[model samples]
Target: GFVYAVTTADLYIRGGLANRVLVIGSETFSRILDWSDRSTCVLFGDGAGAMVLEAGEGAGSIADHGVLAASLRSDGAHKDKLFVDGGPSTTGTVGHLRMEGREVFKHAVGMITDVIEATFSAAGITAEDLDWFVPHQANKRIIDASAKKLGIAEQKVVVTVDLHGNTSAASVPLALSVAVADGRIKKGDLVLIEAMGGGFTWGAVLVRW
Candidate 1:
């Protein structure tokens, strides 16, 4: 699945879904930053990375399968509040990401949590049974709150926002690669990946790697 701003002039694009979704949360804020504007620039960076997840055999529950469950959600009402101003017809130009940070923050927390819980229920797993919880690397505050609400330890979560900022579609897989390469994620371990983007689009992928 892909996450982008449909409310803005930017055209959305996505590719076919393969057998597996490694899941990631990468950002490239620096590449799109107005460096002079510290409020936004200071919150970004640029990079790309990816993860690898193959099909596995399991009984039925999350404990039985590679990716036993996941959830997706959206809300169109707040579209304009956190989107770019220009589009092909309006200004014949692509506008930068304009957001009411705090506003987006509120929706993000609730949505992320909602998806996570749904994923667990669908998979027949409990939050306590999760080995890792990975969320979009949007902000530290949102990350911390989601973890707390889910009763997950802060150390069990993966974060790349400070370095990658908000690489959009690239974030999740990139962080997964980091964890695996660093020996943090191991084979047969359970990982829950979730994200919320401008479309108000969000989803969760629970997998075993």
Candidate 2:
């Protein structure tokens, strides 16, 4: 979600809609979870993240410090695999989060990597070119598999799932904040952010911070 948020903000700036944009991703998954369903409750948490995107000068080179490229993809066909069971109109109450765990894990890695690969191609940079890889904090296995498949080293990946469960929309940005605070992400660093969520939505953004 935050991956696409960055892209949306970047486009807004480029299109002259605004000189600055605040892209925010906040989720309170705990409220919607059914505690009885251990599969869902144990994996999600509340979190918020925001980043400011302001107009900036670019040198028209790889050294440019801004969003370099982005790719977003979604398929409703897989919506049933991971989705809430209720909505205001559908059930008059916020539905509990529901997911086919195996299905989500099966599709997550592939969909995430696809968009990341596309973003990397669009940016004309490979995984090795990234100084930081802040993917959505889904789980360790998915993170490890995606990075391994992309050939991004373990050192370049920023992980915080152990600390912040699955923050849904807040995943990518929350991880970014952690990495930046710890000095892993710095100015002019080529950072790649990626995310996949319950709507079967996924995206990737390559930004030079």
Candidate 3:
């Protein structure tokens, strides 16, 4: 949702459909999590985050104060790897979240880094050019692995999982908010955001603050 929100807003602005958009990502994971299932429940929390994007002028370069490039992708074949067990259409009930943690971790880094690379390529920049890498707060392992694989410096990664847990779609924006509030992200800085969610949906967005 966070990826889609930002991408959609960027498209609208570029397409001359709108000058500004309020993109929000929120989740109530606690409501659907099985409290007894420590593996899933204990790894998640409830949260919300938002970003307001408006058209702005730049020097017609990567330093533009708006979204520069984005890449969104999904694979249904891997959907069962991480998902809720029930839904209204299937069981007439909101289901508890279920996941194969090991399987998810195995593929997460590759999937996330792939889109991020594509985004960087589209923006004509590399990991070294990024001021911050705000990835989904899924876990330390995934975040570390992805950053390491991309060669992004440890100091440039914005992590908030330890402070807020995995808030699903809300992770990226929450981390962004935290980083901005703490002065880690600043005006004119190049920021890269990425996330992989249920249904095997994932994406990346590159922006200049």
Q: What is the per-residue lDDT of model 2 for residues 65-98, given as tens digits with 9 covering 90 to 100?
A: 8888999999999999989886645543567888
Best by the TM-score measure? 2
**Model 3 lDDT vs. the true structure?**
0.90
Determine which window of 10 residues in candidate 3 has minimal summed lDDT: 85-94
TM-score of each: 0.79, 0.95, 0.95
Distance from true location, Cα of 150 in model 3, Å = 0.4
Instruction: Work out how many backbone clashes candidate 2 has.
Output: 1
Backbone clash count, each prediction separately: 14, 1, 0
Which should have the higher TM-score, number 1 or number 2? 2
* lDDT measured at residue 159 in model 1 versus the true structure, 0 to 100: 92
On TM-score, the stronger of 1 and 3 is 3
Once superposed on the true structure, which residue ranges of model 2 sit more than 4 Å away at CA? 88-94
Question: What is the Cα-based lDDT of residue 188 in candidate 3?
Answer: 84
lDDT of 1 by residue, 6-77 (tens): 111011111223444433334555444555656666665565665444444456554564545557777788
All models: lDDT? 0.67, 0.89, 0.90
